[model samples]
Target: MSQTKIGALQIGSALSSSKVTIQKVLDYESQIKDEACELIVLPEALIGGYPKGWDFGTRIGYRKEVGREQFLHYWNQTVNLQTDDLKDIRQMAKRTQTNLIIGVIEKVRSSLYCTTAFISNQGELNGVHRKLMPTASERLIWAQGDGSTMPLIKTENLKAGSVICWENYMPLLRSHMYSKDLNLWCASTVDDREIWQASMRHIAYEGRMFLISACQYLGSPSSLGFDTEWPDDKELIRGGSVIVSPMGEVLAGPIYGEEKLLSAEINLDDVIKARYDFDASGHYSRPDIFKLNVDQEERIKN
Candidate 1:
């Protein structure tokens, strides 16, 4: 597996419903068929929606009745893994012969998790990686994930895995993922800040892996009818989707204020070449001096 083509689809969820978003994804997959991407990564929370400025009506110490109602509505918006219509998504992947890594709000009983689903080219749901630590306010809505769901998917073409959104900031987590000898690192995120690009490049250079960061592009606030104080003309989440080479070179984009699919052809040889001087998990790691311990226990059993 010397070279392969991968793509990152940057688009926001339909504010109306998950079904609409699912259709949007299916339509995009059809349009990109000619691009011939072996692997496609969709933005985080694409199925369930990101809920940009909503606070869920919560504050310190007191949880209001309105908050509870708001929470209930949000919970209803989550994807039920056992009952939801994921067949279409899987079938789409098979039709295109493209592997997919997509983010969705997963509902497990009463709990909701920010999860990334991995779909193989055969249209099988291979595995899912839940966001271990839901950043800041996200903790209020999403339950923290245990390590039991961490997945490193090995395909005939490449060894791939994902770190959702801000998880890229965790040094120890990066070490754990790097130890798996991954060639492709996928990041499904909604963080559209300029600083986020730097982190993507840094991680690619640090891990000596091809990195794909897919971000959401929520257009003008008024379009979504979101209840927020920001001006109606302002963009909610401007996209910054991008792809980076093992050497931290920008291969695809950091396209902003628009929705687009960015693709890059990666040569696996570059991973080895970039690591010749520094392999974070191999030669460069002084095991005698430092070590990392990971707990893979399931926090909640269904």
Candidate 2:
């Protein structure tokens, strides 16, 4: 593994529009075709719209009919794991000659999992990483992921692994990937705050791996066709997508308030050099003092 170019996609929210969002993704990919980004990452739930303000009417401690209806609509808007929609995405990655890590709301019967699909350069779906835990109100809409799908996927030159949104804060999950000797760490998130950005830097510094934190730069609700309570002055999600080096240096950007393509050149040797003294999962481990047990079996869907 030598030097590689990685880029993060910081785009606006598409609401419930998967087709349009995917088209925009392809368009952006085309725009950066010349940049030759070996690894391209998109924000969390890019295909299946990230609902920013739906409470699902659980405030009364009961599921309301209106909330059920909203759930139905959100469910209808999502793409199934086994479908032509995903097939098309794989084809696009193959055509662009680049590996992709895209966040999407994956449909499994009546449940939706916040997931990121890993597509290799050969245009094949490598695997998917579902969010292990949905934060706060997200629990109302998304389901918890099982451990079976949390393995590191090896690409041509990069050992890739992903953790959606707040799960990046999970020390055990980070250790799991670190144990695998990950070269590329993808944090597909909806968080746009400075705290999230800080986590990216810390993860890069801790793991000694290239980190790509992809976050959305969404605008007002009127444009994306969502019902909201916040004023126009407030942003739904200000993009802060960034690419950090193994030494935790900001190599690309922490772009915000706008849509942009953030790119950076990464040297695999740097990862090696950075790990010479501190390898979180390597010689730095204390297996006798700490143990992490994981379940890598895919959860059986009923």
Candidate 3:
């Protein structure tokens, strides 16, 4: 039974500056070096920074010019794929000897998407999974992702996949990942509630896989080094990062109200043990009774 240490970085904030945020991420990784973590999951929008409590001057489909202005500001902050931003992360992953699942706002020319980049330990920018659907106000800033990036990474030890934020609630998507037999599922979210905790454990039990979720520990809008309508006593996002075993047990944390770098040891053998009776993609599945076809055709256009 091989054990892998998984690190969940829950100390992200609204820096908006990729250079600063990337430095902060490197600092956190340095602090976790003693843990010898093989895999690290960062919070969603860690680079672009989660947009909390802003209306963009929109009302009932009426968008003002200021909304356009705000979007341009966001666009400027987004990291371009063919640039130094991702290149630096890839190098960082290689140096640390750790696989990284980093969430960022990806810019491809005039468009932007909420994306998660999977960097291999060898410094390869393996793949990027953009959010399939933007939730609520997020649609204002991010474009929809296609099925092209909906696949898992087969690493040396465990197969990895990701579901960003509310997208975890999608049943068909879950079946898709389950079909791939992913053992290490990375969930990067901004959800700061108890219900999401249950969702993580439930997904782990359902898929018979080890799950790790990383959430941002963002202070109130003002404290986040930005201006917002939130009160002085408010903590915008209170960090509910956690890790779950294949048998639906909590291994690490639901750390709150503070910045934290949390880690937990996971035995890949537990996944096999838990799935002895139910392998969602194999003996436990009624493939003849039900079938799901995924189209991974590239849809990006100039």
Candidate 4:
């Protein structure tokens, strides 16, 4: 590919009901498609909302029985692989010929996973990567993902890879993607402005890959269950979605306190230029001294 124009849905957290949130995603999809974006990425847990922790209990007045019931209802309502909402997204992708990477709460049997689905331009579901490890309060709601589903998805323009939230902190995980010769790294996170932007920069520089780091800002008190009496000094997630080039340059907005669709025209040739200097998994590395074994066979086995 010559140049790829990518878009990111920097959406605000929605109410736990599908009827309430799915329309917002559709609206965002329409807006991004109109911009002639080739790839569109949504934030982590965009379908079921984020930080579904004890705060959810607090939002519903902290009644254990009622909280459990609400949790069950939310889980039941949102746990889906092929819902009408996704059908609309598929149609949009088909019409626009844009690939989609959307984050959703995936229900597998009795477990719920923090998942991101990759949909091709032809509206085919390529694959899904569940968050390897849930962070802090999130562990209460989501189960950890196994190594089975963590393959770097091959697209026409790039070998793309993803890791949700705190998984970005895992050096081994980063190395795993690097070992696969990933050209594009999708870091779907739920962090604030400074940290989010910093992490994107760090990952871009470290992995020598184009980084599409998307984040969501939790502004509404009702959405995250923070009382109005809570400190105004603290911002939940100030959506700092950014597109970092292989040279660690910010191509899009590190936006704060608003919902946005950030886009960037990425040249695939940049990957070639960067690798000419130092390909971490290739020529520049000293694998003769220390070797890291990444078993690609296990991915195909599953």
Candidate 5:
């Protein structure tokens, strides 16, 4: 088939935990089973909550007991891919027969990393893409991902990959992924700013690929009983879930202030059509003058 339906689940972490969040995913998938969406992307940190205003009680140089406790709580919330409750997610995907690209907080030994988990429609854990860089204060909680986890997921129809949140701003990373000739670019993020929409459009136009960005729609943390600096009436993350065509047209949405699934039907041929004028990785590239070396080795810090 030259055409497929894609969607973005513009939701946030549950008020309680990732378990509840997982159930929500299952429920949503069941609701959309009739939509016939071949691929659906979920927001960043959907499994593990994105603590918007917490500092973990940290100081410049000294570590506080409360901070350590906070960190421990967060670590406990992370999903251990080896021994975690992922069966339901896979089963839901199987039931819906839809490919899922979801953001998760991955627990590895003593550290955590912001990562994307790919589940095939047949209920298989295909692979994952760990965020190469964590933005700002995120450095304190999440570890940097090595190139080894940057996978280009190939299916019967097309090639797809994910770049999480701020990692979208990395030009070289974008170029490298563009070189893979991706047909779908999934962005799992919590960045709901208006400018993020621009970046999403730019990436779609530049890569000549369909872009699906799923941003979180989190209300005030205060409602969740956390002490937050944000006003009680304010939303922590206003969703900006959107879908863009290969030619940079807004196909689905840039929806905000609500929780909804945004979907659009796209023709795979559009990727080639958009590239007729500019193919960043093909005829438009100056391979003689510019080259990128990506080390796919998984780095271990001793």
Candidate 6:
């Protein structure tokens, strides 16, 4: 079987403006494509940067009306499903003939969601997945996503799936992907080094699927004042993007402290080979004794 070249674009903060950040993402796309990567995965909320709760203080400083106006301006300034910026990314993807999995802040009517979008090499917009649950301070800004938006996209080359940030910690969510027979699992996160690496290892071994884990390391202090000063010298993300094989091998990177494009040629057959010994949701799981049901549709319906 032919191998697939998958990549993780570990990016630094890009909070300047929608246009500028979009350009940055596009530039990185060009760099990755030149390296012959078939798929490129970016960090969470890459278009707007992480922990946008910092902007709230700026919003409060203005008069009530001014604050409202400024809030509207910034809110409108964020990226979404239909933004022209995405069109640029789509066009680039078509030009390079490389699939892209991007994380963006999606604006839907009056509300915002932490969302991930998949685009084909031909620039076709695939389905999107929003964060099922926004953790802690994130709840202040993003609306929790419903189950209806959850997706598992099948391409000619791979049956792929994704979940945002903390959702990787959800066992049932991972099981849902496993039930779908997913071969490639994309996890976009904003977690620290230890938790991020541990989670990647756990998912690869547990699911017995290839994992492309991309995390943003925004050095910006928690907007909720968790820290007195930014932990790092510069308020930049310390990247921890990696690719793990089915056997829990670290294939590419857990590259830290820099923006980079890490790539690896992964053989799809490894998934089946690993499963030959044991599949967590299959032979390894004694369902007759204990079963986990994930009524995703019902959860969202309520």
Q: Which portions of model 2 show Cα errors greater than 4 Å?
A: none
| lDDT per residue (tens digit) for residues 112-135 in model 6 | 788888989889888788898998
TM-score of every candidate relative to the true structure? 0.97, 0.96, 0.95, 0.88, 0.97, 0.87
Query: Scored by CA lDDT, what does every candidate get?
Result: 0.89, 0.86, 0.85, 0.76, 0.89, 0.77
Give the worst 10-residue stretch by lDDT in candidate 1.
Answer: 76-85
lDDT of 1 by residue, 1-302 (tens): 69889999998898568888888888887666877888888999888888878788888988889889988887877787776458899998888888899999999889999999998989999988989999999999999889888789977788899999999899989999999999999999999898999999999999999999999999877887787776789899999999999999999998898888889887899999999999999999999999899998877665
Runs in model 4 with CA error above 4 Å?
A: 52-63, 82-85, 222-235, 293-302
Residue 38 in candidate 4, Cα distance off native in Å? 1.7
For model 3, how does the per-residue alpha-carbon lDDT over 1-302 read when each residue is reduced to its tens digit? 37778878896745567777777877765675666788888889889777787667778858899888877777777888777777777887888888889899899878888888888889888888989999987887788999999778877787899899999999999999899889988999999999999999999999999999999888876666666677866988899999999999999998998878888988899999999998989998899999999888889753
Of the candidates numbered 1 and 6, which has the greater TM-score value?
Answer: 1
Instruction: Please estimate how well model 4 matches the true structure, expressed as its whole-model Cα lDDT.
Output: 0.76
Pairs of residues clashing in candidate 6: 217-237, 217-238
lDDT of 5: 0.89
- Please state the error at residue 88 of candidate 1 in Å: 0.9
Q: What is the lDDT of candidate 1?
A: 0.89
Please give the distance, in angstroms, between residue 80's alpha carbon in candidate 5 and its true position after superposition.
Answer: 0.8
Show where candidate 6 strays beyond 4 Å: 52-74, 83-85, 217-228, 231-236, 289-302
